[model samples]
Target: MAAPAAAISAPGVLADLLPASTRARAVARDAVLVLGGAAAVGASAQVAITVPQISPVPFVLTTFTVLLLGAAYGPLRAGLTLALYLVAGMAGVPWFTEGASGFGFPSFGYIIGFLVAGVAVGWLAGRGGDRTVLKTAGLMVLGNVIMYAFGTPYLAYATGVGAAQAVEWGITPYLIGDAIKLVFAALLLPGAWWAVNKFRSQD
Candidate 1:
């Protein structure tokens, strides 16, 4: 009898890892979060600054979601979900700027930067900055920097430009937009967390 009871309790013991409410809300949260992220990638895809001077690169809002998703989801989940965005875009889902499709291009580094940005934001969020708007901006700034870390190299390789020139053209041009995104994501992420926590606190 005791042996059977132990067997029955094993699943429950494993289930206790994430806590009751947190685990229970996972299904709804995952659907809302991931799908919301997908939609965001699509929306951000539209926010672009096109200059014929630099047709290959345009400023966009995807970086904003990169930080916000990481902050909201935590590092691993954020990374995985961002992977989904890239994979989808690569699969010709039109999640990139100007509804671009296909992959294996020069700008793929920017996509990689999105992944790094998510991880950076998620790492900061895991450290308890989820409810803090100011810190969220700070963290996003750092994340945007890291985004450039990955993107500059790819841009250089793709455009046949020297590393220094790539940084000047690809990374430098985007800093102002990324800074704006930091402000936006800071406000956006903490605001959402506050609402969710406030509702939960009431309950």
Candidate 2:
């Protein structure tokens, strides 16, 4: 038999594609997703390059990973995932950028922002924001802006710099990279949805 119309029309996030036949099984699945997602973000955080002359905030893949995971996981799962990552890092897991831990770091605010942005993107994705290239692009941009909103002010406070200087140090140097990542996600997310639909149609 063909899949249900609701299933075809609204698959929700990518993770929703997984089957969970029982309540206990569904709970177990979500638990695994949260743990795995958090670990993925932490692992991505290590892929960083610091150009202190440009900014105290190192260029890291953490934001990209977090945003994508959020879209795929949906709000509750993504929020839990980021919460796990944040708490573990603050508790000295040393899984943060450059294997650093604790919260006083200049980039910690960005990490905090990740939790909020993850939830935001996941909420958007649940409402079909990630189903098309244009929507995905806009979603990614909003996620990045949310991060900067939280990150810049905290950076200023941590580094004892003025707001303008904080933007210079924390936001300016990353614009190009953020744009690149945004474009990549815009294309990749919609493409994944297309592929999934195509596969489902074939089945």
Candidate 3:
């Protein structure tokens, strides 16, 4: 017989609520999630707008997608998903922003930041950081900060600009968009958890 939901350890994320029936099935499910998550990020990357006068780094939807996936998938799956995205994109997959690939781009550091922020967000979500509006908001903010931390410096190095200039080009232009994304994520994650709980109660 399957273990009762209450008998299982606390779930790291919503995905963990659907426990696998067997060890092999669990592995298969995780593999699928990783691949699916990576594809989602890649697809979202295509939704980009570049203002050359403002920054070489195109504003993209991948940040919102990555953070949500991380909160939903938890640490291991999120990490693997982002790692796969990075490796595949570097190996000639035209999945990076605006169908670009093979690294060395001015925006490549933000891609790297996605991997790290995904893992960080997933780790926090595993500890119940995504279950409330305030906590989820903070988590999203931290994830954005992580992305900017890595991306700004690399933008500087890649374009031979000073730190202040990099911030002006790579980050300042996108602050409003980032804020909007963060607000949506803050609402969505906790709302999903509430839905999951309601479903489980009905079951």
- Model 2 scores a TM of 0.96
Q: Score every model by TM-score.
A: 0.77, 0.96, 0.95
Q: Which parts of model 3 have CA positions greater than 4 angstroms off?
A: 1-9
Best by lDDT: 2
Q: Best-fitting candidate, measured by TM-score?
A: 2
Model 1, residue 2: distance off in Å is 35
Ranking by TM-score: 2, 3, 1
- Residue 121 displacement (Å), model 1: 1.0
Task: Score each candidate by Cα lDDT.
Answer: 0.71, 0.95, 0.92
lDDT of 1 by residue, 100-199 (tens): 8676566678888888788777876777665677877788878878888887788788889897788777877777777777777778767866765565
| Per-residue accuracy of model 2 over 61-88 as CA lDDT, tens digit each | 9999999999999999999999999999
Count clashing residue pairs in model 3.
Answer: 0
lDDT, residue 8, model 2: 62
Candidates 1 and 2 compared by TM-score, better number: 2
Distance from true location, Cα of 88 in model 3, Å: 0.9
Candidate 3 lDDT over residue span 72-160, tens digit each: 99989999999999999999999999999888899999999999999999999999999999999999999999999999999999999
